[model samples]
Target chain A: MRKSTIIVLALFAALFLAGISAGEPERVLDQAIRICLSCIGIG
Target chain B: MMERVRRLVQVVFTFLTNGYWAFPFSRNIYQGPLKAICSPGLNCYSCPASTTYCPIGAIQQLMAGLRMSLEMGQLYLGWYVVGSIGVLGGLFGRMVCGWLCPFGMIQELLHRIPGRKFDAIPGLLRYLKFAVLALMVVALPLFAVDEFGAGDPWFCKYLCPAGTLEAGIPMILLQPDLRHTLGWLYVNKIFFLVLFVVWSVFANRPFCRTTCPLGAFYGLFSRVKMVRLSLDEERCTECRACHQVCPMGVRFNENPVDTNCITCLRCQKACPYGAIHLEAGGVRLGARQSRPAQAQSS
Candidate 1:
């Protein structure tokens, strides 16, 4: 693999790990559970 | 022969992703762990049978949440959605559009319904998708807040013919209450959907070329994606046959890694010199032989 590609991959991995640690999966679930009226342009 | 295979694969994928066959009146949205994960393509989250979340919708929600967190004195990010998009885009680029997107397949099928075909938009107009990604998906949700500190999903609300087709129409048909609440916005969306359907019959992937923000996002990774189309200059005869078959109108000879190229591999099949092939992680997938000269003459 190219050095640049490797560097980009490592950076993405670090970001992904950081996001996993910080994100509250529960909150995402709460949002996902209900249909957002605005999402369908109803509200 | 290759075209048939592509169409077959598309049909199979469409059926598999949207396999939930319940009564049309049922308003149940699947609330499983799969709903938490993003689908590889642009399936609407509100679709009654959708097994997964739409990545674009998820990201907009996350961005809206970011604005709310600003007032709460804490930060909240939808890292899972971002990571999923990054990983998927980096791996396959816009291959998802060609192979997986139900909407893309729908448009292709619509185009096949014998009509006057023409290029609906200029080549340079393809840049509109990027503006949509930046403004509607990112900026509007981040800044356009409501009294409750939540931002509207602008793209889904105002645009997104897919949402109009999959969710709005179905929900209206199912729920009497929703039908009672119909207004100009709903009518406007329906009008747009009709226009898109008409345009697709005449133009090749007008939405994919001009309006799809997801395609624009994935196209960004085409240059460095792990799996990509590579052209062999030595073997290439510059016959321009690939150009004729490309639905996206990408000039593969000039740039095999053109962001617009959907990696559909039609060009690979069309190449008479056996110059184009798909490569994944440095391994060649196949070397298809060129069609015989007599076949071309015939």
Candidate 2:
């Protein structure tokens, strides 16, 4: 594989691992539970 | 023939993701676990039938939380959102824009309406999406906070026509209570949506080309994405037929993986010599053509 391709793969892997460790799924669940009025431009 | 197939795919996807059938008007926003996963395209989170969250909205929320994280002395980012976008982009690039985005389908259908068509889009305008990503989605949310450490989702609040068309208008129509709360921002967003609708009739994908931050994010992965367009040089005659047919004005003969390309496969169909095809992880996924030795020798 090309060096640049390898670097991109490595970067993606590292970020994915960091995201998994950060409790990203739970955080997303918490946020998704409510509607953000501001996001709809109401607030 | 291929165009018909593309339209069919778009229609099917649109129906599948639309939540109106479930009568979201009477219920609260879906709080399902599926909402944790990010949809591949730019569907609105507030869309009642939306099975997953919009990645752009998710990212903005994460950015808004940055102020709180700073005060708490701990880093809190929407890792799932980031990871989903990264993984999806790395795998498919902007194919999501072509094949999956509900808004993209709307724009495409709207563009089909008979009107004066525009061909040239200024090169500078293409860079506007990246600027939006940097300033509206990232910068404003991170810096433009209030006394309570809560920040505005600038892009979603001020700019996103998807949120306006898909979530804003529908919600207001469904709930009479929301109609009373409408303000200048709502009017401004409706005006923006109207302008985009008119613009799409004249120009091809004005939003995808110029303003969509999700497209900008996915575009960053175009060069390295797992699913990619490959050109067989031997069969290519450099006729520029593909370029002529490309809705996004991509010069496919020169750069098959141009960031502007949404991978609608229009170029592949336009290639008379059958020089272009899609590949995933080095395995060809579609029709493969070999240049006849006689033709090559001639």
Q: Model 2 chain B — which ten-residue stretch has the worst lDDT?
A: B19-28
Off by over 4 Å in 2: A1-10, B290-298
Tens-place lDDT digits, model 1, residues B1-298? 8678777878777766666567364566666666666677887878777777788887888888786676776555766776777778777889989988999999988889985799547967899999999999999998898888788788988888888888888767766687767787787778778888989999888889988999999999888887888898877777798888898989899889888888999999888777888888667887666655644454
Write model 2 residue lDDT over B1-298, tens digit each, in one string: 8678777877777766664466454555677787776778888788766667888888888888877866886556766677778877877789888888889989988889987899678999999999999999999998898998878889989989998888887777767788788999888888888988888999889999999999999999888888888888878888798989888889998987799888888888877777898888777886576665554765
True contacts kept of 2: 0.47
> Model 2: per-residue lDDT, tens digit, A1-43?
3355557766776776787687776776677656667767798
Q: What share of the true interface contacts does candidate 1 keep?
A: 0.35
Candidate 1: lDDT of B243?
83
Q: What lDDT does candidate 1 reach at residue B51?
A: 70
Please estimate how well model 2 matches the true structure, expressed as its whole-model Cα lDDT. Answer: 0.81
Provide the TM-score for each candidate, comma-separated.
0.91, 0.91
